[model samples]
Target: MSQHSSVAGASRPVKEAGFFTKIKNVACLKSSSSSDKGKGGKGKSKSLSNKVSHGFHLVEGQSGHKMEDYHVAEYRKRKNHTLGLFAIFDGHLGDRVPTYLKDNLFNNILEEPNFWKDPEAAIRSAYSSTDKFILDNSMQLGPGGSTAVTAIVIDGKDLWVANIGDSRAVVCERGSANQITVDHEPHAERRRIEKQGGFVTTLPGDVPRVNGQLAVARAFGDQSLKAHLSSEPDVRHVPIDSTIDFVILASDGLWKVSC
Candidate 1:
């Protein structure tokens, strides 16, 4: 996997207004205050279940550029033990890499022998293995690449996050947002890339990118840059407390538009 330019060329003009308008419409429709009074004055209410103590919600926004290749998944093994995993694979040139990651990464992690005992090690193994799997199967996948950021929430008490790209995970607690996963941007994550002899630059007609090709510094599928881009994820064991609220996991599209 090698990074390629996603910057729209001269043919694709940026549609700022249309992009934001669609986002606004989707946001409004999902809002609790939105009224559904067409067929009747009553709106469908979310069922409350006392047995269901914890739940998960996921929403994927469209890509402002080509297709939204990002993928997300949330699963629970048992009623009390919940596992929430979300990934943003910013694909460049094609969607094969992201789609491949979405289908295989979590399963690889869960299948690891050490997963039940040591989640951090399991995550590391899973990341490396998945990357290798992609490279081995690259002939079947075309010449595209992707950045990966994944988070796993276990039992609503522990969070293990891994990343190799600019996709972000933010924890909104006590009315404030705290970034959980570090954005693997060349500019911000310069130290790591520099240690590996990698650099960042902007092409003559392209957006700022890592190594003049990738916009992100770390990633799993960039086989060409494996010597520089990392696959080891930053793992943290966080205990969910009273002050914690819902977290937001989004791709570069949302972060680029918002930040």
Candidate 2:
């Protein structure tokens, strides 16, 4: 079945969450529920056991520029296992890259030959291949790019997370938050960019940027800055247990604003 979501020209809000000491609840795109799109581009779903669910809300940004963000939240059956897929693709310059990712990234990753035996290696391979495809077809996809954070839950038993740029995933376990992805900001990876013959610039009042153009040092597409950018993602694996509550996959406003 198709995903329950993908934001169009709108960087929608995720689940409505209010944090007061006693953590109430949060939402995710339901893994087993049918599409539940409502007014204003919203959708909700629940897992087969009804133990976990997801929801989304869309809202346009006030930056004047059309929103380029896109997302994925759905479930798929593969090899007798139920896989819950979630992701956030924060784009800049245009929406082409993120839109393409929302539609194709997971497919490519799942199609990797070694995905079942060596998930990490398969994920890396797919990430590299996907980025190559995007860069190779820059003319058709445009010169824009996107930062991404993706999570795959295997029957609520294992969780796999991977990311590039600054899109992030935060997991709540026993009511404590833990970040499992790393941000590839220009400032953090300066030496690497310089080694690629690109320089990072930090003006007095601005954040560090790759060659003074893109704010992130790694992402998909960005053919114009491909030489200085990396598309490799930092992937992690976490075994799920009773203590784990939920995971939030998104690029917070801090990352969103810079892009």
Candidate 3:
């Protein structure tokens, strides 16, 4: 249980989006035990009691977009107590912004004193605070922007998930897949963007995009669009009792090919 420290904001150079153009295949690692069932199954239990195993892999496509820009962190404080997170961070101009977020965002969320008791509020607070921190420190990070989608697994039974931008997470249950993240396309997020004084555009055969520069209406970094592009993440809670088998968290490139 580490606390998050606020960092000073600064401006830096931006990276190119070419690194994210590659396609990749990812597989979920099977766990040895079912999180839904307990030692004796003696009725409902509370306080994060369960066991689960998780795994994932990534491969880059020929588009020169290396798969390294994405960031993932898994921390288990103790046996059966864990946190798993995934973020796609599509960089329009450079990778510094996404890389910085990958390194700091989750730590900031977990370090909040309220997270243990109220995961949702803590997640929301962290999302906004982190975004502000990024904007405040834009000068240090340089130019560029990144989208984030993160899932926190606690006690193997309770899951707190959040996302800002187009990155996504999906749950697999009973041999079927259900999308848990909402794609914040310009069309879908039009009203929100308009309220924030932003605009959207669409090309033939393509979904609406924000200002024709990005598909997601919100994301981290992109200081130039901060007024319209938000870093607020949509948060959800999933219980272990539900028919949950596994989950997949991916970037746009993977989604482009798979979906």
User: Which pairs of residues clash in candidate 2, taking residues 3 or more apart in a chain or in different chains?
Assistant: 28-54, 29-54, 30-45
User: TM-score, each model?
Assistant: 0.71, 0.84, 0.75
What Cα-based lDDT does every candidate model obtain? 0.57, 0.72, 0.59
In model 2, the Cα lDDT at residue 17 comes to: 40
Superposed Cα RMSD, model 1? 9.9
- Candidate 3 on 1-259: residue-level lDDT in tens? 0011101000011221222211111133222211211111111111222344344334445554433244453444643355545444545566677777767888888888888889999999988888888788889876667777788877666777788776777765554557787877678878988898888888898667777666778788878877778777889887855467555566665566642
- The lDDT of model 2 is 0.72
Can you give the lDDT of residue 148 in candidate 2? 86
Q: Please, what are the lDDT tens digits per residue for candidate 2 over residues 1-259?
A: 0112233111122332445121222232223222222222445675554555655444455556666667777778899888887777878878788888988999999999999888889889999999999988989899899888888877778889999987777777776778888988999999999999999999998778999998888999988899999998999999887677666665655324433
Between candidates 1 and 2, which one is better according to TM-score?
2
When superposed on Cα atoms, how far off is each prediction in RMSD?
9.9, 5.9, 12.6
Write one digit per residue (lDDT tens) for candidate 1, span 78-193. 44465656555667667787778877888898888888689889998988888788778878765567777677767656667777777666664554567777776677777777
lDDT of 3 at 190: 84
Top of the candidates by lDDT: 2
